[model samples]
Target: PRLREELKKNYWIVDNGYNSFPTQIPGEGGEMLCDDEIGDNIIGVLFAAQDTTATVMTWVVKYLHDEPKLLECVKV
Candidate 1:
């Protein structure tokens, strides 16, 4: 409810004859996305991003610990 209200307040639809764009909704080919689809996609992206960040951070820490010179270079 709050998300919908915020989106409605901040976003406006633009219709330029050939295409219609809903600024707050995620869509392609001029199709409007439903709230459930948008929510699912957002959740999926958040999980993927969180997983990737954790993996990258783990690798960075491992490399930094293995190579003191590389860590020093990064700090500088």
Candidate 2:
């Protein structure tokens, strides 16, 4: 607890507890902001965004390749 005490002595860290999101670490008084549990939540959000974007891009490219006439029209 010496490190914690030392850090707190120099810096004033407070847990606001406004956000209920899950954090990487449990409890407060560490390096995390407000001791929020954000490990799983952030990972899920990032994965979802990445997967959806890839799916859309893949479909768009496949559609464009299949319909060369449609692609040419868009260029003009």
Candidate 3:
């Protein structure tokens, strides 16, 4: 119930096909969503993207740091 309420407060489901733009811009063609939905989508995506990027970056950095030879080989 709580989750549903929160979803209702944060998301406004738009009708399908309401967001066709002249150019093919992913997600930008979506219908005009309510402020809450927009905010939720922004926050949710940012968090998810940031978390994944950070995790991958951390692993990559660690790998490079621990394997300088490998890094050098790649740089060549």
Top of the candidates by lDDT: 1
Q: Residue by residue across 1-76, what tens digits does model 3's lDDT show?
A: 5544534443432223232111111233344456456445445545777654454455456667999996897599
| lDDT accuracy of residue 32 in candidate 1 | 56
Deviation from native of the Cα of residue 5 in model 1, angstroms:
52
* Segments in model 3 whose C-alpha atoms lie over 4 Å from true places: 1-48
lDDT of 1 by residue, 26-58 (tens): 355435578567546545545777754454455
Clashing pairs in 1: none
- Write one digit per residue (lDDT tens) for candidate 2, span 2-72: 65664454343223422222222323555543412442434445578875445445544666689998679
TM-score of 3: 0.33
lDDT at position 12, candidate 2: 39
**Candidate 3 weakest ten by summed lDDT:** 17-26
Best by TM-score: 1
RMSD of candidate 1 to the truth, in angstroms, is 15.3
Which pairs in model 2 have colliding backbones?
22-37, 22-38, 23-37, 23-38, 23-39
Candidate 3's error at 72, in angstroms?
A: 0.5
